[model samples]
Target: MPSRLLPPAGPARALAAAQLVNALGDGAFLVTSALYFSRVVGLPPTRIGLGLTLAWAVGALAGVPLGQLADRRGPRTVAVLLAAATGVSVGSFLFVRGFLPFVLAACCYATAQTGLAAARQALLAALVARRDRTHVLAHLQSTLNAGLAVGAAVGGIALHYGTRAAYLAVFAMDAAAFLLCALVLLRLPEVGPTAAPAAPGRGPRFTVLRDRPYALVTLLNTLLLLRMPLISLAIPLWTVTRTDAPGWLVSALLVLNTGAVMLFQVRTAAGVRDLPSAVRTVARGGALMLASCAVFALSAVDAPVWGAVAALLVAGGLQVAGEMMQSSGAWQIGFDLAPADRQGQYQGFFGMGVPLARMLGPLLLTALVVDWGTPGWLLLGALFLGAGLALGPAVRWAERANSALVSVG
Candidate 1:
């Protein structure tokens, strides 16, 4: 850590640190949110889940518009605004006694989160060179997970000892992080949006949807996202309410998942960094996810607790592997392909698929399960596997298109 040898200690570095801090707070807040809604606010699981869906929908709908705004202004300015807005929104939760006000606060927080996310990703791409982009993105994910580990542990402790005060503390920390992030962003050199790159001939922004290869990548992302509901809402509810498992098992399972991330994500992610093959990377990630789902399906057979635990560990490892591939591929395509001017818009539009899936997937799975029993989970697994298989053609198309483009240039 010699001073002269260190990477530039500017806005980019500062913003990355600030993201870690804010993520820590977010992690703590999420850990307590469900319990707070249930015990403090007296909302049932279904209502809580519905609220999450609404928040996600609001965020997803706002993402593209926020990105467009970031293009007009600067990504830094938009990011700062988003951070401050999120801080205020989270702090407002303290006074919200009823469902309506609470939900409103959640919606506001979600909207700000999406805005900040678009700005953050765009900022990263703008700051880095093409060769280093994948490494930087991987580092960001690892840093976030590290922050989450600390936050989650602290949150659990806070809940066990302090209850509602703990959650409030988490929000307060988030607010502070937002303020710090804004300050750090102000110190960094302003990087203009993609509409105004230094290079000649390339336009300010390339329309991502019009590019079939990128569009297919986005579509694959959406399809992959549909698989997340199993872990996010469906499996937890099924395990806690539908099965004989104890409520504490949910926490245990999460621990297993987090542990796998801690142990495996970085090492696994390095192998897949920003190769020219988006489709192949995505396919690999999808295949791992499919395997994880199959393991999850096996858990439905009334195995012993140890057997279930084993399945959980295996599934969790698969999740980490999938995440590594998906994350690497996503940054490679979204950041590398975009010209300097429109990175914000491209990343923003592409990232919306995540929130869209979050909103839609759970509802569909829940309804199907209610109507079809175990068949719903089976169908979900099938969808994941099919999505993985379908990515082969998409990847081939991307490879050929890229080759043709390179040849023409």
Candidate 2:
């Protein structure tokens, strides 16, 4: 019965299906990417990291322009083209023999992926009502995780085989998935640009860069997103090195996170109907994350193995709760605060935070929490609390400014 509670038919379902397929491919690729590059492709570890890092940077830079293009053209059209490009770029990885070719292929894949994401968000905004956007987003997130879980399992087969041919097969599957996703997108109804004509000299180009309140909100949301690395990278390392918990608990923690999102992401989105409610959701999520941080700190204590495992489970649950809440709230804020006409550009700018977090989070968390231990966790908690508290005021400021702009116009 719960499985039957799907997204409504039409564009929403289509988009969700496409995202599920694409994300499944991403999940498979992610599992094998590092190993495939190093072992199969024969690139050095440092080169792989460097290439991926440069790729991400290139992708981040591509977002704004591609999003703007989506606004100028149709989002559906742009999205389809970008998806095709992504598939081609990813498939090209099979031919990469050295650092330069690898980096080049990575940049292409990352750029297309980023651009496709912005286009997809804009397309979603076009298809769904403002009131329903966050709800739809929640469903999409759940579907993505589910697909990723399945894909990761499939990828594990290749990992187990540990053969070049098997890895290539996985890469080919990922490429095909992207092309399939593109076909799915083609089935959706075409939605054109929402922007109205600008007055004599006042164009909309780069306007998101100048919007201070929205910019601040994006910054705060990015800080909140640091939870990603904390769970994925730091927690596992901490569990093995510092805690008394068994190594198997690391897998359990990841499953806990993915399982929570699949089960509760949609449920959590129900309460976030308006800007005020969204803001409250984010604040509450921040508090939950702060508490989770403290709990995670407790896991590092000199406790019995069972006690540490219990602490880890509890902390992981809290972190997932916080993630679902914050994610839903952030989607609402990003969608609601943007000028309706420029959703593509605004969403593109908002998305820049993700790549930035991915770039900086590991170093920051490793230095603060991983290296320093309990004090680092406490400091991270303080950061979360401070950022969460600041969100309410920041959102209010953005709303007022937007209202002022509307009245002036």
Candidate 3:
């Protein structure tokens, strides 16, 4: 059962354990952050949002540079430093009382979090064989979901108590989690960049951006990531305002989504071996997402509450299935397409898609699904379907470009 829950006892296991611990803390922090700032710190909602937005922006900008640093300095070392920084940043939030301090702390946390992600991906790329990367990622994702479920439940207790001490304890726990993650990373073997240094005046300084095919893949991958906001932000709102489902269904939907990821993420990843298979998986995920959207839209019809509840359950299941598939495919493709020597930079570039999606997804979904209603939902579905179909061609183009580069070199 332990082996079933994770990979073998090695660096993979350590990484999985680190991810689980970090995610648990993150889950608790995510649940309590808004309330902590609003109620405990007495900051206004607008200020809180602004601070977080700026923080994410800072983090996004820092990703590529920090990733390149990982290439130069070694991923394991860089990841450890970034993890420590994350802990410090989260801990600093304890002192934030006003806008500027909040922004500063949040930005620090976000930047460290983003940089840590890139470095960790590079570390994984170095530690694991290419063939096993996706499988390992799947296990990590399942572990993360399980940790988040547990963390969220624990956080709910604090939230229920609604005390400043509870909020403070949660923050301290999150900070401690980062520190513990850093300690785990410290024990991993050093995995340096795999590629030789570039020839003088030959390679582009920023190889990832210059790689148009990979860029297009990244953009399309971002489209698929719209599911994050759709599930987290849009779905809850939709359930409350647009559908006949009971309010309690919102919590149930979250549980359903998490449960599905825990159950099937690893299983779904088993088939993704090569570029073609990975691309196919992503395309299929897109179709599933489209189906999910359509089913969710159906819940808006004047149906019985049971029917709406049933539709939501179905839709949630489909959405999580799609999520698992897309994640598997993205990891496979991102790792495969990346130049081994520049894994840090390449994964950093790929990682940018998530923040980009987070920045825009909520507004886009709100405008389309919430404001525009069924028409918007259909439009959104069409957009997903089109992107899914386009991913194959995009991947092919990337492969052709890589081949051309290799031939020229």
Estimated TM-score per prediction?
0.83, 0.97, 0.97
- Evaluate model 3: give its lDDT: 0.90
- Which tens-of-lDDT digit does each residue in 1-409 have in candidate 2? 5443568787989999999999889888989989999998788888887788888889888888888888878899999999999999989999999899999999999899889999999999999998999999999999998998999988999999999998999899999999999999999998887765457778657788899999999999889989888887899988898898999999999999998898889999989999999989998898898899899999988888899999999999999998899999999999999887788888888888777777778779988888899999989988887888798999999999999999999
Tens-digit lDDT track of model 3 for 1-409: 7677777679999999899989999999989989999998999998887788888888888888889889988999999999999999999999988889999999999899989999999999999999999999999999999999989988998999999999999999999999999999999997765555668988676788788889898888888889889989999999999988889999999999999899889999999999899988988988888898899889999989999999999999988988898899989999998898899888888998877787778889998998888888888888887887798898889888888989999
RMSD of 3: 1.3
Question: lDDT (0-100) at residue 346 of candidate 2?
Answer: 84
Off by over 4 Å in 2: 2-4, 196-204
Candidate 2, TM-score vs. the true structure? 0.97
Model 2, CA-based lDDT: 0.90
lDDT against the true structure, each candidate: 0.70, 0.90, 0.90
lDDT per residue as tens, model 1, 1-409: 3322222355445655776778788778777877877777777778777788899899987887787677767887788889889889888877777778877988998899888888877777767766666655665666676678788877787689656776677668767777776776777668665554336765544355566876776677687777567566766776655545467777766666666555555455555445446546766887787677666666656777767666655766676577667667766766755546677777777788788888898778777643455677567656765775675666567668867876998
For each candidate, C-alpha RMSD in Å?
A: 4.4, 1.4, 1.3
Where is model 1 more than 4 Å wrong at Cα? 1-15, 41-47, 161-164, 196-213, 238-249, 273-275, 367-375, 395-409
Q: What TM value does model 3 have? A: 0.97
